[model samples]
Target: MIKDKYTYINREISWLQFNARVLQEAEDESVPLIERLRFLGIFSNNLDEFFKVRYATIKRIEEAGKAARSELGGYAASELLEIITQIVIKQQSESLDILNKIHEKLEDENIYIVKEDQIDESQHSFIKNYFIQHVSPALVTIVLSDQVDLPTLKDSAAYLACNMKLLDGKCQYALIEISRTMDRFVVLPKKDNIDYIIMLDDLLRYCLHDIFSIFEYQDITAHMIKITRDGELDFDSDLSKSFIEKISDSVKHRQIGEPIRFVYDKTIDEETLRYFMDKMSIETNDSVIPGGRYHNRRDYMDFPSLGRTDLLYDKISPLPVKGLSLERSIFSTIANKDYLVYTPFHTFSYIVKFLREAALDPKVKSIKITIYRLAQISHVASSLINAAKNGKKVTVAIELQARFDEQANIDYAEQMVSEGINLLFGVRGLKVHSKMCVIEREEEDSIVRYGFISTGNFNESTAKVYTDFTLLTADQRILKDINKVFNFFETNYKIFRYKHIITSPHYTKSRFFKMIDNEIENVKKGKPAFIKIKLNSISSYMMIDKLYEASRAGVKIQMIIRGLCCLVPGVRGMSENIEIISIIDKFLEHTRMLIFCNNDDPKVFISSADWMTRNIENRVEVTCPIYDNDIKQELMDIFEICWNDNVKARILDETQSNIYKKNDLPKVHSQFDTYDYYLKKLQS
Candidate 1:
């Protein structure tokens, strides 16, 4: 157990601070204008998910009358909910201010984002025609009343709460659902080199007359309001339904789940707000946030570029990995030596190439892979289907519970099943979070195995923007362990021992603890001892305590966590030897890596798991040790580059201030520098 004096930050509160860093990117004038707007959208989207998942979870605990102090890092569930609401309110207000400033900047660049009243003659005809032809058919308008039962509002759907004052003393209230199928941003015809854009909310306000023409109202008003429902899937006890059917039913039921968050425009009139609140049965304890004019500002992520490339960050071409050729046979190459592919810096086509080769090679008799998420247009899925058609035994273990991507995974699973590919839903009560593929081939009168392990999903779309690593090898030892994992998926009753890779829920914590103990022993023996790690988040108390123990033993520790770091770094006698930083930049820092100095002979690993309890104890994750000396050096070099980043890196200290790492040395933008590093290696 971690001592109370160790000082752990609440995960929810730390996540809010991470979003605050996103808001900082939006407010940063040094960033490109259009990219800054997208950052604002990203900030809003992150908050929406936080409420739906984290905040909803806490609300459930409060309703259950559980303090949950220990689970929540010492704060009671009710207390944490109040703190989250207050922090979110401040963030929302700051985001609105940032949006206003961005709008002013856009105006300076001859890009005017106009309101309903700002529509001029040049855009008037276009708006009317566009609405009649495109939006009118898609619109869902409900005329609400007290006499009739209110319809259950769609979760997270933006609605214009319409208040109409009739000629008589009575009033009519209606809600117009914004058509999600249509573009949230509508661009108007340019006039004299000046570009004009308007949000869909303003467009709806302008067309209110056309919508409610029969109401005979003297005046009408519309303000945006949105509700976020609890997103946790509650399974049914139906025995007859298949696993897929149960999951599908749960996803459908999510729409009517209890409300956890309600956001509305502060400018909205009191009568309308109260009426809707009462009708929706919103309680005072619910997260009722007063927001800006727009509710779903996440739509700003898709704000049209308008062909102004100058106003956006310049796109960099993904580089080719050294010694890896997409045109060559990946199996033949990996048989010789293990190679690492770092994505976004390097093109993701190598992964696709590997799968395609496995599909066509006649000697390749079988393929096994674990998938968490796939791209919408997944070449990886197509390749697997192709392998199945070519008489290869292809077995896929696809996770259907990848949050927010569940429906997409379900659709892909059905398609794969139809194509004659064997699908496994993974072991009961354990999520298959590992990203790995193993294949067997007939080689010179004997069977040989080849495979790849990754720190991310094999999704091509995300691979373009998420920094991840994939290691390809033909090592028999590692491939044997990979095969054993697939067997466990098939027959989970028998727990198997793995000699090479670390598997979660059975071995990850113990293995890591042993490794840390080795480092501590080396420190005591007067040898160089240090630990370096990179992960998206770390919150497990046992893991944090182990690091504290190592720190107290005089072993230096450095961490680069992208989000949700709960351990209080730099606390004397607790984590005095520990320092942490987080990098928020163009590409998400998603790779999980660990390095330990065992008497100067370093041991390095890349994993799918973070230090969170779910990953360590509930999910089936894999941590693969880097055996190739070259790849080990490459990983260490990249970590050092990121550690020394003066730009985009924020020191994650006790204050949670998100201060940038700055020094007198020449600026090192790690993302750009890493790309250059790979480019130079390719040239060499």
Candidate 2:
């Protein structure tokens, strides 16, 4: 049973495996060509954040001489860091290969990504004029010397390391910060009905002669270099400063955070690389990654369509839930039966409609909501503000520390605070990650509570690509628990007990464990017993151990996990009853659901929390039970739809091989099939 002395794969490594699935999409020629390029971009973006957050954390632990194995799952922190570096280097190399193949394929479609040398005479004038008109003034170039101190390189932006060799046996180094304000992929004037585009990096390379006209140099070479810094924001314990002020300062200071990883082109000159490491005090043990000619591939996410509809996935108009009406009162509909709004398949306007109705309704006494992340132009914030202006008591618990969205939330936080709305900055030592809203409406007989809980944020932007579930219910039992969670936010010193919804930082772990224990007990009693779960990630060792115990008790477990799963299933006698599969498809699988068999009576829940320890014990999260039988059946149906997906599902076993869960049975692409499912549901 001792397989390599460890039952689970490292979470970081499992995370990389998950990313590799994204990369696999890029490699699959069956996918649209332009979509493949964007997949490469997503892969790059995910890697950048991984290094910034996860890798940076392990580096700090290693630096403090506390590189313990237990803290990092199994390997010591130093060893884990080395392993991560090696894996990233390999993945970077593979990404370059996939990119080159995609470029070749793009040419077959009459779309070309030409390099600096590859541009023809017809495109020369347009390129030069475009550069002089657009690129010259925006450029920031710094000449390097021993006397002059190097400017702190931005972690998010990419830079070109310029090496110049002068006539009199001397060499000089310079840095050119790539302007993120400009587009990375520049579409040149179309010629002969053929689309031609050049990257911003190559455009600058083409204009290097013009850029260095002032300085006399024999030769100059530019190569891409990028650095990622620790993304964790440390707040000051200043009693005088408000929570917003502390968070604002922390976000500002994140720009100059310590470097966690340094990436340079493999062909970069040793002299320039050495000069950079020496000047920046980059140690040998630091993540020194070498990659291809270009970095910051994330900009590819916005790759120009070039009007080629044939080269992209066909856009699907979001389907409307049958019973939920957008034009009428959302509360009136929810008061009867609970409705589930599945995004990318179902329209997100229902959530907006619910809030807007609450905002305008004269009977609505008050609204309380918890916000984690919102879009740039958020309808959610505007609705909440409108409610405040309408004289309704609106209390907002906006988490100011929502990672990269901190500043955006802070801006809205200040605006909401100024707009006569009651704002709770955050709970001390707890980041409120729950997505919940409860509104009190004064009916003729009594005050009624109508609320919603979601497995995703209320942001309208992310709803397009991210698949999440938002449950709209008028069940007072559940809304009572939601209101308690909100009340506990204000009075955090006092603990609140909930009967319907399982909350984190106090009850999620114990309550969920009890669910698992029930299944285990039922299995021992020869009753029907099984568990099904859907999650973005699950790395909780305690949760894993409990599931293993259930598996040993012959309680069947099936998981549709989209991201980082450290649990190794399919091991004989240990996890034989547990089977896990991950689906990486056209849309991000972001739904979190859990189901347990209670003597053939199924109990199901939709949650805002994953099984990750942070979501369970460190943050404020919520899991609401499905009391409405119709909604419960819907959850079961969708989970089975996702589970039965053979086209995108990858088996999550001890090997971490990510093999497709394929058989002779008909192939089921869940994303498309899900939309069809909703379509049939609407018809039925």
Candidate 3:
């Protein structure tokens, strides 16, 4: 297959479309008003990260003189960058319009988002006092002048650019950092059963004179400007430094990474905008986005609900897995048969219960786990520490380079060390992106292994909103492979073989390629052959080519990819047998699962990997095969439920239009139906 014939979407363009789906949620009328607003916030937040990581990467590629067009899925880096900028500018404008529409609808419900100028006499005292107490001390305001270079602007932080005209006709400029310590949305005192809210931005706008009373300004204007810098950490060649030390230094340096994007209020004066462009050194190729008055709209994600249950999605109590019990030993349940825990549908407490049980279980001799990102207040860390406190040997391979989570993981690593838990900073070049845990327990006459593997982080906070699968099993074949992974962390020189679980940086690519080839061969013999995959992304060209090979051989392929799928599906002769859909709704579609119809007998696996080159060859990831027949059926059923969803699922095609899969059949809102599927199983 020549590079020219390989048809795949540019990952950057695909990612922008994924975010547009998020924006679609904000635009969807059926979504609860509060959730739609929060979706807009999520959309904004997702864009920030994209600019920092993906967009920044493409900028570097363009600077390196265009050698990686094949790698970028046939689009030139410079061309892709321009296309991304134009798409974002258009989305940013649409987001502003959507926000306005939401606000108007909010007013229909007597929930007014009153600006500083819109605030009446009834709200003045509250706003003034709120500003004095909450906003004043937390604020970081800087005055700007031509004589001084701008303070190293923090990446992804929103700042208000002020253009003040003094009584003497002298112009002064300033930048005010929005207080992260305070809520961006301030709820004012209620009047006549009507609620009024003011954004911190507008509150600051109202108090401009008070903020600069000493300046004697005749006029003042402020507009939001947010700059995103490259988030890639560049470690120095300091050999003697500890991994933690290196990570700390790199995080500090990340604040000063070259700017990849500069977003400002579209209505800001040309003079102010140009001053920002020149002073900030925003490059000609760097994305210059014209956003609304509110730049860091990610804050809208936490827009206070104002005690309005009617305006929010109905909360469902997380149900328990049919047979797994928090009261009983989780090991005992897994010891019987493999049990899968689908989170948001099933309670996250099972994971905590398992760890806490291990902490207290006398038979449990040792515990080994992998940590990526943890909740701010993590019970998982506490449970592991408890096990260490109880004289059980606890080993943790915490990835210190978990992107934006480096500092948090470092802090937890220090705390775990203080608690006497052995810590591994991951292998030198490969990040430990795999999520698995194995506990060795003293059974009658022999030691037995019990473990769980997950498709997402073990953070309970995210568990509530992100849909993921965690499989609990005492199967020796899978447990042995998991133990080998932990063993490799301690002894990086050894190359271990696996029979049941597929591991990365060694076997994932070859194993998956072999699987795809098997399907293609099976189809050649005129047997039933098909592939089903669910994942967060699939941008790997090698993996894409293999899939195209399978598709060409008439093996049907169905995919539920949540984000950044570069494969150009439904193309004649290239990928006609493949169809992919992405679902974005109340809960993020986060499970990474694969099923293969091998000569009518199915093979199933759940994975902690996307088909990205990073996951396949650059990181330590694990893909565990499902051995238990019942659990395999359960996984298949869940996949079918998502695949059949007409409400939230959107077709992924050559156009990248993100049109929802519409049908006249009885509506299947997959997430809701999935929960009910488990509920019905419990009753039966």
Per-prediction CA RMSD (Å): 0.9, 1.4, 1.2
Candidate scoring better on lDDT of 2 and 3:
3
* Candidate 2 or 1, higher lDDT: 1
Q: Write the per-residue lDDT of candidate 1 for residues 13-59, one digit (tens) a residue.
A: 99999999999999989899999999999999999899889999998
TM-score of 1: 0.99
Residue 255 lDDT (model 3)? 93
Query: Once all C-alphas are superposed, what RMSD does model 2 give against the true structure?
Result: 1.4
lDDT tens digits, residue span 1-684, model 2: 221226777889999999999999999888999999999999999999999899988888888988467657778888888888898998999999999999999989989999999989999999999998899989998988989998998877899888888877688888889999998888998888889999999999999888777767899999998889999998888999988899899998888999998888989878888888898889877899999999999988999999999999999999888888887788988899899999979899999889999999999999999999999999999999999999999999999999899999999998998999999865788889999999999998798999999999999999999999999999999998899998998899999999899999899889988989999888888899999999999988888888988999999999999999888898887789999999998999999999998988899999999999899888999998999888889889999999999888999888888898998888888889889998999899
What lDDT tens digits, residue by residue, belong to model 3 across residues 381-481? 99999999999999999999998999999899999999999999889899999999999999897899999999999899999999999999999989998
Report the candidate with higher TM-score, 1 versus 2. Answer: 1
Candidate 3: stretches off by over 4 Å: 4-6, 283-285
True-structure lDDT of candidate 2: 0.91
**Which candidate number has the best TM-score?**
1
Location of the lowest summed lDDT over 10 successive residues in candidate 2: 1-10
- TM-score (all chains, Cα) for each model: 0.99, 0.98, 0.98
Worst 10 residues of 3 by lDDT: 1-10
**In candidate 1, which residue ranges exceed 4 Å CA deviation?**
1-6
